[model samples]
Target: MFRRRASVVLLALLLAGPVIASPPAIDPAARNPPPTIALSHFDRFELQPVTLAPGLETHKGNVVARQYLDVDVGERVPRLIEPRNATPVQGEPRTLLIQPEVADIRFITGGKRVLFGGFAGSSWALVKLRLVDKATGEVVAEPQFLQHANSIAAGYSLGAADKLMLARLADMVASYLKTNFDAPVGSAVAAAAPPMD
Candidate 1:
């Protein structure tokens, strides 16, 4: 009977061990602090037209890519980052100038994507985003974002895949700004900045 009791207790202890050792659940907000405090200081935002890097001037899709980036990001910022608590700016409204420059792009044609899928290589774009304070002429943040459309399923949508990737990149930029700008000042650490891509 003692041996049986000992075995049962040991089994109970084994089952409870993991439960006792488990860490307490942490709040999601606490884990991810704001990425950039400088963004929070602005009352308004002005997005410059997206430009191509010097070498990309002759790229086939340069015009389309620039237009997409400009439109998508411009539309998304107002939807995502605006309507937040506004920090009062003295005299002129504190505006953040957002400049996105495409560093590189590899666009796979819809026909090729449909026929060859991943073998045609993924459609990707690398954009360097610079944020500047209009009032102080201070450069706030410069982050690089690389976005890709790589799903075999994306081939079904053909040309829409590249558009979707561009849209997602815009969403990411807007979301990042919203997350960082909405947080309380001093709450975010630079080391905890969200992944660029």
Candidate 2:
């Protein structure tokens, strides 16, 4: 009786070993390409292209400063068909919360322009921006940052200028991030592989 019980237990163990040792099962829902990252609207607001009087001009001023996104992925990362631009490795997806933003705007009046000798004031707004991880600047997979617009100097137009300027600044920053750095938005984190032993 003892020998029979041992044989049955040994058979069960052998059957279970391979199943547990195999790679984690990929989710059926993830066979399709992942959705584009669903970027959110700005959570807060503030003036950009700001400067101090004469101390710094538009070209030398900081264009923007604001905060957005503090994300935490609560579930398993379904297997993802990484974007064409994404780099692949056998590792887990990181806990990421991208603060996608445009920054560093300098708004100042040019020395002086001719407003019938009264001088047409020219407002010069130069922008520089980036995508910060808010979590760590040292991480390699961190989003790539680029600066698109520069010295959009316009004191000539008198209507909706601020909004338009802001819009341009925002768009350039977004476009920059999209073109460089990080994986495609909404890509999934991978699971840890089972031990080879």
lDDT of each: 0.61, 0.28
Report each candidate's C-alpha RMSD, comma-separated, in the order given: 17.3, 30.8
lDDT winner among the candidates? Answer: 1
Provide the TM-score for each candidate, comma-separated.
0.64, 0.29
Off by over 4 Å in 1: 1-36, 81-90, 111-119, 184-197
For model 1, give the RMSD to the true fold: 17.3
- Assess candidate 1 and give its lDDT: 0.61
1-197 per-residue lDDT for model 1 (tens digits): 99986775565434322222111233324422333554767778777778888966665555667787789878777664456425455786778887878767765555555554444445677666777888888777765565667645456676678777777767666655765575633322112334233
Candidate 2 residue-wise lDDT, 70-150, digit = tens = 010001111121232154435543332333323222222222211111122222232333222334542223221211222
